[model samples]
Target: MPQMLLIVEPIGQRAERGRADGEAVYQRMLDFAAELQAEGLLLGVNSLGSAAKRLAKRDGGAQVWDGPFAEAKEMVGGYFLLDTEDEGVAMAWAERCPAAEWATVEIRGVGPCYM
Candidate 1:
């Protein structure tokens, strides 16, 4: 089966709302995940921490930068792995996501890889 990955991005007022309504948001996600699981559409789900780090190579050496405060338009807050046959259906699921009302849900098809 084809898989769709939903990447959740929260920015600006959305980010603030996520913090202010953390528990409610968490419950909403839980409910959404449960619905997907009941429909056999969800494979897995995870929420990311605010702490983030950037790895870079500067003049042949390694550099590490810490952030939850990067000057970026949005931060990746969570993700869901979904099993589905059609891209349109996967997109529809994303549209139904609770975060869709306040955040951006980016849908991407999972590609196959060979070793």
Candidate 2:
């Protein structure tokens, strides 16, 4: 099984931190990823940009919206996919994530939607 750690952060939080602070925080996350990789637990990782697009179908028509969306209070800042079968191990890793210090770290199991 695989687990995903989603980094959820408030909108504009990165900007508030400014470039220097943001880079420092990002370096911490990179270090964390390196540790996970060294432990053979990291499957993949990536930081997400706030710029996004939303698509929907309405009455057989395609609708597209570009963000920053007005209704969004939070955004997914990043994700870490870990190769693990134990949920406890995943939870433990989530607890150790650098993002947990300032953002929400959401743990999720990777599987088909029907499941």
**Every model's TM-score:** 0.79, 0.97
Highest TM-score against the true fold, candidate: 2
Best by lDDT: 2
- Pull out the clashing pairs in model 1: none
What's the lDDT of the predicted structure labeled candidate 2? 0.96
- Predictions: Cα RMSD each: 3.0, 0.8
Q: How do the residues 1-115 of candidate 2 rate in per-residue lDDT, one tens digit apiece?
A: 6999999999999999999999999999999999999999999999999999999998999999999999999999999999997889999999999999999999999988998
Prediction-by-prediction clash tally: 0, 0
> Where's the lowest-lDDT run of ten residues in candidate 2?
85-94
What digit string (tens of lDDT, one per residue) describes model 1 on residues 30-106?
99999999998888899877678999898999988888565876778888888886888888888889988767788
